[model samples]
Target: MAGAMMLALADGGSFTLEWTHSVEREDWRETWEVTEDHRLHLTEAAVKGSGAGMEPGPGGHFEDGWWVWAPDLPPVPALTLAASGETPSAWTLCGEDCTQLGATSGQPVQVAPCPDAG
Candidate 1:
């Protein structure tokens, strides 16, 4: 499967990210690619979890920057990610207790600064 995220640029030149992942077809591992003015590419692959819903609990991990997980689900406010997964069509992140985070598409998944990186 394939998905994309749009990067809004001030110069009018937008950045785009493309990703592909699959469980059955190992031919294409879960990976993300970015393209923009700066010439750089990431070849490493990461397992894009294939699951759904939150697990509920304590602290967790998350990526940086302001993000919107799902516009359809309830708002989660500012917090850490407890669990995350990719469905057949979209990416989702949730707090430790698996509270609802709105549906996010064509946009950043974790907008706030990533906690795991720090």
Candidate 2:
């Protein structure tokens, strides 16, 4: 799952949403910690139901923060909210909604498509 997420992030124009469900007992104490390493630490927890939540980790940090939840939580397929590029193309955001930022494809594309052959 982590590898898949990394690939999505590499695109620099994608977002993911995950849902979870499980039983939560009173004794359950969920402690979702966001380490400086950018890895999610989903501590003790119990989903109980279709509980949905989204956490925005430290932004701008290419390698920082994470999202964590209890293991009991239901395995919700990751949702690709949006994926836009400089090219005028439609992206598949899956079930997740998307909002474009800035104007004119936003920033420039980093990589070049190698010299085109005539």
Candidate 3:
């Protein structure tokens, strides 16, 4: 399985993130919106399997500048976002087993193609 988080600067100084995971020939995507106050909102979630479901709750927050999102789903990667100079710009997707799928450093984010993806 592989996972990644794409970050972009939204209008009004907020941010938008799209977290995606590919496993078992299926893809799971979670869309989020971060406010200027650092509050995260789970705007939408979709999965190829009917067994997969996400519960929206207190979502996430920025800790010292890095945005952290920890959900109750197993095997789902954790999302973290950090800034380079002033704004939150970089992100990392860490699997539950501690495997890091991808990360970014200020430029356009890209998920390293997973050889095992299917």
Model 3 misplaced stretches (Cα beyond 4 Å):
1-8, 11-23, 52-78, 81-118
List model 2 lDDT by residue over 44-118, tens digit each.
332223223333233312122223343533322232222333333332222135433222433322211112211
Top-lDDT structure, candidate number: 3
Better of 1 and 3 by lDDT: 3
For model 2, the superposed segments whose C-alpha errors exceed 4 Å read 1-30, 49-118
Ranking of models by lDDT: 3, 2, 1
Maximum-TM-score candidate = 3
21-83 per-residue lDDT for model 3 (tens digits):
322333344554443443444454444433233322246444443334445433212244333
Clashing pairs in 2: 21-73, 21-74, 22-47, 22-48, 23-48, 38-64, 38-65
The alpha-carbon deviation from the true structure for residue 8 of candidate 2, after best TM-score superposition, in angstroms, is 20
Q: For residues 1-118, could you state the per-residue lDDT of candidate 1 as single tens digits?
A: 2453222222112222222323322121211222332222322222223333322112322323211131222222222222233523232322222222323323334423222221
lDDT of candidate model 2 versus the reference: 0.27
Q: Where is model 1 more than 4 Å wrong at Cα?
A: 1-6, 9-37, 48-87, 91-118
Q: Once model 3 is optimally superposed onto the true structure by TM-score, how far is the C-alpha of residue 109 displaced, in angstroms?
A: 9.7
- Using all chains and alpha carbons, the TM-scores for the candidates as numbered come to 0.19, 0.18, 0.31
